[model samples]
Target chain A: MHTNEKTVAKILFIVAVLCGLSALSLADVVAGNGPSPLIIFDGSKDFSTSSVEFGTVYRGPVHFTHGRHINEHAVSCGKCHHDDSGEPINDLEFGDGVDTCTDCHYEETLLRGKALEGMSQEEVIEHYPNAMHELCISCHKEMNNKTHTLSAPEACRSCHGVKK
Target chain B: MQKKNSKNMKNGVSRREFMRFLGLTTGAAAGSLLLQAPGLAAESSGATLPKFKIHTLNSTAEKIYKCKPGIKRFNEANMAFKQVGKEIGQPFFHPLAANLKKNVANSEIGSGIKVDSPDEARMHLAFSMGAGTWNNMFGPYGEGKENQGLLSWNPLYVPKDLAAHPLHDPNAVDLTKKIKQMSRIYGADMTGVAKLNRKWVYSKTCRNMYDASPARTKPMVFSDVKTPRETDGELVIPESVTNAIVFVVGMPRASLQLSPSSTQTMGGTGMGYGRMGLTAVALAEAIRSLGYNAIPCMNDTGLSVPMAIDAGLGQLGRLGYLVTPWFGPHVRIGKVLTDMPLVADRPIDFGVTEYCETCGICARECPSGAISADRERSYTPPASAGSCSNPGALKWHVDGKKCLRWWMESGNGCSRCMDVCPYTRMTWTDNYDGNPDPDKFWDLNLAPFGYQSVKY
Candidate 1:
C-alpha cells in the first residue's frame, strides 16, 4: 500500500509539472511574440533543451553566433520575427527587443497550435519546442528548396557542434 | 569591326538597316537607294574578320575537351554564399557579420584581424566571406536603380560614333600590338588574341544572359534585343563575333599564399574578381573607341580557360588553372569578342603537360582532396560527376563538387592548393612580358632552370 501510494504521488507530480508548463505557455500565447537574439546552447547550461535536439531524435545543444547573422549577414530581420498568428512582424530592426529565443518559443503557446474545447490530448502537447521547429527550420527549407546543394542545416549535428 | 572575310552578302540586311532600326539613322528618306549599292560589299565598312588557323589546340587539352552548346546558369555553382547561412543557421550570420562588415567598411588592405580564439576567428572568417566579400559587383545591370553594377556588360544607350566606325588601324599587326598594350594599360596582367572557335562559344546562352543585347533597344522596334530571347530558356549568340581577345588579371599572390581557410585567402580571391570586372569594362571601352563592336565578357557565355589557351595566353596546369609563364595560376581572365582585325598568337609549347607528369604538389595539398594526384591527365575528370565535375573532357580534373562543398564548409572559397604552388611564387613582376629570351620556350626539359642563371 505504501509503494502504490508513492507511485500515484510521482505520477501526479509529473502531471502537475506538465500542467504548469502548459499554463506558462498559454500565458505567453496571450502576450504574443516580437523578436529574439541569437542563442548558443552547449547542453551544459540549462536553457530549454528540446525533447528533440534542434528538432531531431538526439537532444544536443545548438551553437548559433548571433553577431554574425543579424549584423554581418544581410538576410534581414523579417526572416526570423513573426507574430503569434502566421503573419510576419517585419517592423523589428537590428538589436530591437532582442532576448532569449526560448523566452517566447519555449514558454509561450504559438497561436497556430491552439487548443479548443473539442480537441484531443495530442493537441495539448503542441507547445514550445514544436512551434520553434515549425517556424525557423521551415524558413530555411523555403530559402533553399529550389537550389541543388543542401544550403540549410537539416541534420542532427550541423548547427549543434556535437553531442555535448 | 570584322575584317578580311567581311564579304557583303547580296540580299542580307546591312548595318545601315540595323542603324535605321535603332532609330540612329533618322534620314531614311532615300528608301531603296542605300540598298542598291552593288559594290558596297567591297567597301571598308564590311565587318568580316580573317580566320587564322589556331595552332594552340594541338595539345592534349584539345584531344580531351569537347565543345557543347552552352552551360546552365552558375546559380548552383554560386550556392556557396547561401548554403552557409542556412546550414549554420542565422545566429552564425550576425555575430561574425558585425565584425566582417566593420573590417570591409575600412580600407580592405592587409590581413585585417586576429580574433580571441580559433573558433571565434573561424566564425568571423565565415561571416566575412559569406557577407563581407566584394560580391556587390557581380549582378544583373539595367535602367535606373537596377544598374548597380557594370553597365558595359549591357547594351543600353550607345552612341552611333562608338558602334559603327571605320577600323582605326587597318593593319592587323599594329592594331594587335596597340590593343595588347592598351589591355595591359587597363590592368590586364597578360593579353593575347586568337581566331575565336565557334565551338567554344555557348551554342545558346544559359538562362540569366540579362537580355542586354543591342536588339533590345527601348523606344525602337529593335527593343526585342534588350530582352534576351530564349527558345527554351537558352540564350543564343549572333554570328557576328569572329575574333577572341583575352586578357589575364593577377591576384595578390601574397594573400592566396596564406592559409586557404583564412580571411586573407578568400579576400584576395574576391578582390581579384572585383578588379577583373573593372578591367574588362575598361578594355571593352578601349576597343569600342577604336571603332569596333566589342562584347566584354568574363566567365560567361563560354569557357574562359580554353579561350585563354586558344589566344596563346598560357597552357593548362595540373590543377586546371591557366598557368601563364609569368604568374602561373595566380590570375583571373577576361575577354572582349570583336570583329576588329588582329593577328592571332600561336599557342606556346612550354612543356606544361610533361612537367605535370612529374608534379603532384597541388593534388596532394588540396584540403578537400578534390584534385587528382595522378601523374597523367585523363581524357575525363579523374573525380566522379557528383564531385562537381561536368563530364565531357579528359584532363586532370579537380572534383568541383567537393571543391564547392569545402567552400561551403570553410565559409570562404578555399584556395589551399594555390597557397603552396611553386609556379605562383616565381611570378616575374614586370611592365611587359619580361622574359624576352629566345630559349625561354626550351626550359621545360631542364630539371630546374633557375631564372637567376639568365639575365633578369
Candidate 2:
C-alpha cells in the first residue's frame, strides 16, 4: 500500500525473475570459449581417416578418426556430436562444425546463456581450455557408467597436444 | 521463523509467546492470543493466520515465475531469434510449426499467439479470476459449461487405499480406498503418493491468516493459496496428510506426433490439459467426500515438480520435462493435495541421464536453444528454469522464456523438440520386447491422414 512496500515488492520480483530464469538447468560444460563446445563431428564431412605406411607423408583434410573414438569408448555418436540444432549459441553460423560444449553445460551458461554474448572470438578462445576441462571432467564423473574411461587428463596437452 | 504472541497470558511467559505459540488446540486459544497481542494479530484474530507475513516479489511474480518484461508482453512481441529464410508469412511453411505454436501459446502464454497484447493479458486475467476463457477449453465440471466439459461436476472420487491409511481408525481406510478407486475410474492413467511436504507449499503467494500465537502454525480459513511447497526455504513436511497421491493422464500419441502443426497438435495437448482438469476434479472431490480438505490444481498453486518427484511420478530429464517411465514426457500432470493419508512411491533412476546423453535430439531440436547441452556432472543439473538465464539445478532446465519467445516468433507454437525427443516416442508395446513393434504400434494411417487434413 505504501511506497516503501511497493519498492520492496519490486526488488523481490526482480530477484524472483533472476531466480526463475536460472532455475531450469545449470550449464557446467564449456563450448568454444566458455562451456566446452558440443562437438558436431559430421562423420561424412568433418573427418577423414588414413592407414599410413611408414614413409608416406599424409597431408589430407584434418580427418579425425571418428570410428576409433566411438569403438574405443563404446559411445553412440550422439554423445560427443549432436545434431546442429542443439548448439548452445544458435548464431554460431556453423551448420555442422560447431563444437562449443560448455555453451550448454557450463554452470554460468546453464544458468545464463553463452557468457561471451558479444565478445570477440579471441576472448572466448582464451577461456576455452579451463571451461573445457571443467565441462569434460564433470561429465566424466557423473557419466562414468556410459564410458569406460575413468578420468580425462587435467593437462590440455593430453588430447590436443599431439603431433605425429 | 514465527513471531511470538501473548505475555504469559496463559502461562508465566510473555504475551508474545502465547500469541506466537505453535501448539494451539482450538479457536478460543487463538482468540485469546490475538486479544493479548493486537500488533501481532494486525487486522484479524491470531487464531486464523500462519506465523509469517505474506509478501510476493511484485504483482508479476503472481504472473510468471520470472518477471521478464517480455513475459508481461509475451503475446505481443516476437522474441525468438529466427533464421534468415524463416520469416513470418513465408510461402513455404514449416508443416508442424502452426500446431506447435498454438499449443505453446495455449499453455505458456494462453490464448492464440497473435492475440493483441492487451487482449492476451485480459484473457490471462480472466482465467486467473476463474472467469475461464474460450481457449481455456476445459474447466471444472460443475463450474460451468464454458470450460468445455474438461472436468466432471462430481469429481472422480478415488477411495483411499485402506492398507496405508495413516489414521488409527479402521473406517478411514475404507474412505481412503474409495477415493483412490474413484480416481482411476475417472481416467487417471497412473497414481501414487508421498507425504504432504509443507516446504513445497507456497509461503506467500495468496491471501491467508497466520495466527501469530506461535503456539500453532496451522491456518484457519486458508483456502485460496494451496500449492505444494518448495519455496518455504525449507523442505518441511506437514504433520497432517503425510502422503500425496499424484496422477498422470497420457495424451494421444497421434496428436503429439503432429506437433507444431496447430490443428493436429491441439488434440494431444488438449487431451493432456483435459486430463489434468479431470484428474484434479476427481482427486479433490474424492478427498472432500472422505471429509478431508483437498485442493484440486490444473496448473496454478503449489510447485508441481517436487511433488511429482516425491510422488514417484517421474524423474527430471534433460529437456527439463518430467520423464515418466510409463509415458516419458508425453503425459500431462494434475495433482490433488489433501490431508488424506496414503502409501508413498519411491524415487526411480532408470538411466535417464545415460539416455539423454546418448540421445541429444531434444536439445538439438530446440529452436530457442533452451535445452541444456551439458550432461549431469554431479548428481544435479544446473538450473535452467525461468526466463533468460537458466536455473542452476541438477538436470537440464529449459529456458521457459526463450522457448516461449521462439514459439511466438516462429508464428507457430512449437513442439519440434518435444516431437523429436526419443523419450516422446511410444516405447510401450504388446510385444514385450522392450521396443515398439513398428508394424503394430507405429500407425501408418497417420502420415496420409495428417497430410490431407490441413485447414490452414
Candidate 3:
C-alpha cells in the first residue's frame, strides 16, 4: 500500500477500535441500537507508558479497559458513565490536546451536564475539598471490599496536608 | 459556439467561478470553508476552553499540620506590648512614635510645629513617622507604665479633653466634611463607612489615660462598660450616626520587609494614623459646621477591624488580620464615624479561601505560632464576648497572646507573620537573567514589594 494509504488505514483502525470499545462499554444502555455513541480515553495512562507525538496536542487514545471494569470491579458501565448520541460533550477535541476538569470546570460548568445542578459557582469551586474525598473513599471502599485498606478520611488535608 | 462551450467545460473553476458557486448555497460554503480551520472554528464557537491552575504548597507540609496532629499551641513570643517594655531603655525611636513625639513636644514648648506649606508639613510628618521622635525613644504605648520609667509625654497627649474641646462638637457638619477632605488631601489611599461594631472594642481596663496639665494619672475607664447607662450607650451614637468612614493610608511595603526596627514600621502606621486623626478631627468639625453629629477619633471611640472589613476594602486572612489585596496587611487603619450618608462597597471573595487552604506559610512563619495550624473550628476566648474567634467562621485566626509574646521578644515588635504573608509580597515577572522585576515603580520603592517580587 502507498504510505498515505497506510497512514489513513492506521488512523481508521484506531478509530474503529475506539468506537468498538465505547460501544461495548455502553452495550447495556444501547443494547438494541446499531452502535454506542460515547468514547472514553485515559490520556495519562498511555502517554506515561509509551512515546507519542510531541509539540502537537492530541485527544488521548481511547483504550477501552473493558475487562478491568467488567471482570475486576464488576462495574456495569451504566453505573459510572453514559453514552449518548451527539457531538461528544464534556470532552472537546481540539487538534489533539484534551482539556481536563480544571479547564471549563474551573470558573464555569463545573460538574456539567446534570451530574450536579443548582450549585452556585462559589459552592462548585468549594466542591473540590469534598468531592475529592468521595472519589477516594469510593475507590478505597471498593478495593478493601474483601480485605482491610487505608481507613483515613478523604479530606483534602487528610492527604495533601497543610502548606507552611 | 460548441467549441467555446467545450473549452469552458475543460478549464477548472477560477476564483470568480468559486465565488459564483458560493452564491448558490450559503450554508454549504460555510460548512466546507469551516473545515479548513477546525481549531479556529472550535475556538470562536466556544468549543475550546482554557484550563486553570491550582495554587498549593508542598503536600507533606500540609499533612503535617492537618493529618498528623498534635496539641497545636498558639505561639505568643511576638507580643508588641511586651516588646515596648523590653525596648524602653532604647530611644523612643519608632519613626511613627518619633513623629508623634515631635507634635507632643511642639505642644510642650507652647509653639506648635508650624508649617510654611502643606507640602513641607507632609514631608516633615512623613520623615518623622519614618524615623520616629528624634532623640526621645520612649513611645506612647509604654510611657505611662511605671515599669518602663518613662514619664512625661510630649505636649500632644496633654490635651485629654480634645473630644470635649469647646472648638469641636460631634454634631458639626462642616467639620466632618473638612476632616474627610483633609484626610484625602493629606494622603489617605482609601476610605470607607461602617457602623462601629462594639465587639472589637477593648475594655477600659486594657488601657490607661494620661492627663499632664493637672499632673494626674488615672486608670482608663469607660462609663458605658461599667454602668451600662442607657444614655451612655445610646448617646454614644445612634445606628444611623454609627456610620464610620474608615481610612486606608498606604504603607511602603519595602520598609516593612527590611525589618528595620519597631520604630520604622510604627512610623508607617503612625503617619497613616496621624493623617487619619487630622481627617477625623476635620470631618467632625465639618459635621458640627453642618449642624450634625460627628465623632472624630483615631484610636478610641470604637473597634476598627470589623468596620474596615464591612467597608469592603479586603478580606481577613489566615493571620487574623485584614489582608487588602493591594497592600496586604502592610497598611494601618483608622476611621471617623459620622451621620454622613455615603455609598458602601460590596464584599469580595477572590479565591483567598482556596489560597489560604493550600498555603499555611503564615502559620509556619509566625514567630509566636499564634496562628492556628488546623482547619477552622469554633472556640471562645477569655477576654470578650461577641468578639469573633479566628477559626469558627471559615477563617484562620492568629492567637493574639502568642503573637504578643513574639512582639515583646523581638524588641521592636515582630510582623514576621505579616512580613511573610504571600499577599504582602508583590507579584513580579522574571527577567532574562532570572532576576525579578517589579511590574510597577511603586513596588521598587518598598522593601517587601521588592523582596516578594524576587521570591515570586
Q: Against the hidden reference, what TM-scores do the models get?
A: 0.50, 0.44, 0.40
Quote the lDDT for B442 in model 2. Answer: 32
Give lDDT per model, in order: 0.44, 0.38, 0.35
DockQ of each: 0.01, 0.02, 0.01
Taking chain A of candidate 3, what TM-score results?
A: 0.26
Q: Which is the better candidate, 1 or 2, if ranked by TM-score?
A: 1
B1 Cα displacement, candidate 3 (Å): 99
**Which prediction has the highest TM-score against the true structure?**
1
Which segments of model 1 are wrong by more than 4 Å? Answer: A1-164, B1-135, B138-158, B203-236, B428-456
For candidate 2, lDDT tens digit of each residue in B300-379? 33455556766655566667666665456766666776666555555444455566654555654454455655443222
List iRMS (one decimal) for every candidate.
Answer: 29.8, 25.7, 29.6
Cα lDDT tens digits, model 3, B1-456, are: 545533443353455754554353233223212111001111222222322221222222112123223322111111222222222321112211232233333421001223344444344334434433311232222222211212111112212222122232233344334444444443344554444444333332122322102112222222323111123222223344546677664444433443312323334444444444444444444443333445555444444555666655455676666665445565556665555554443343334555555455565544334565443322322121112232223345445533432332222334555555555542111111111121222234223212222222
Order of models, best lDDT first: 1, 2, 3
Better of 2 and 3 by DockQ: 2
Kindly indicate the candidate among 1 and 3 with the higher lDDT: 1
